[model samples]
Target: MNNNNALLIIDMQQEDGFVLEHFDSTVNNIAALLDTARQQRVPVIYTRHINQADGSDMPRGEPRAADGGPSSYRAGTRQVEILERLAPRADELIVDKGRYSAFHRTDLDARLKALRVETLIVSGVLTDVCVLSSVLDAFALGYHVRLVSDACTTTTLAGHYSSLLIMANWVYALEILTCAQCLHALCDRAYVSLAPQQPDQFAHQPHELENTIARLHSHLVRTQE
Candidate 1:
């Protein structure tokens, strides 16, 4: 809602490594967020997971093509491009990275600093990988984050919710929200969010994952405005 907030969309490329859960709905959700952000003049930043065209910058152990190029998101390829529907406008920021976290070896932090951004509203793909790592790094960089839980997905629903719970438990300055709630917040309206009141609030055993995630979701909607 404040000018200090930014919409950080991470790795929403055309890469097809995994058939992500709820990918279509997630894209629609993010598109809605983007539209609203543009309407409100909120700064929108995007991260692309670009690897070297020749695999020179590929991280150790990353898969490679027969020509020794990075298997995915290789530079100059269509797959590394952001989804056409979610493409950035000229004024929007785009951060390209070779690593999972957008902040890793990138100028994202410095750019956010120049913009005077204090909070990040995060969305995008691979909930257990890039999204997870980026959210954690955002927290570490002292940026308060609002995670749009359903606007990002992983290969499985389990991985999606598990990563969310991990952030809820330890990312102390986080507020786990849905796409609707985030929109409400952006518009300066009353909205319900599942921010942790204490550390380890969503702590649960492996087998209790679903129950824990359900409990978290219940809190988000129970007090809806």
Candidate 2:
């Protein structure tokens, strides 16, 4: 990953915002990556889900319409608050986005461009929806996209896995990596210490990783040749 890359933490808000069973698991890893991003002085941008009628702040029929209703966490609602685990610090940019793509109707691209960011590291919930939509847009907008597989979750396992398959199989230059791999790449270290939700959540460490990055190297190697 280049130093000019920015880490985009998409829509990881309160429980109502994410609505996933394994929400904590995803948040934990995203926070871990954010930690590395901070330590490395990488530009970090947090995208908040907005709504029109309390759903998403961008009103319906507007240029930037979001598919889902205004999540309770959007804007003034408590639901819009970034989960404490991966909350942004004062220096980071908090982008308000009504659409799936952060660049749609938002100044995300401009902000990144101003920072001279050429690559984007993406993580968030609803793997097949918001995450995929934003990543595809990032790719088209000329940013190298890297999806943090373990740091993103969906309401269903099938949808989550399916998105990963599609991203890995077809999206050229869009890489799928585990939170660990990404963290290490940013930190330039071999061992990454995860910021778990609780001290007892150790069991989730490797188990959660196995499904995200373990197979990516082999897949990438084959695709490269």
The candidate that achieves the highest lDDT relative to the unseen native structure: 1
Give the residue spans of candidate 1 off by over 4 A: 221-225
The number of the candidate with the highest TM-score is: 1
Question: Each model's TM-score?
Answer: 0.96, 0.75
Instruction: State the TM-score for model 2.
Output: 0.75
Candidate 1 Cα RMSD after full superposition onto the native fold (Å): 1.4
Question: What C-alpha lDDT values do all the predictions have?
Answer: 0.90, 0.71
Ten residues in a row with the worst lDDT in model 2?
193-202
lDDT of 2 at 47: 85
> Which residue pairs clash in candidate 1?
none
Task: Go through the candidates in order and give the C-alpha RMSD of each one to the true structure.
Answer: 1.4, 9.5
Q: Which ten residues in a row have the lowest lDDT in candidate 1?
A: 216-225
Candidate 1 global lDDT: 0.90
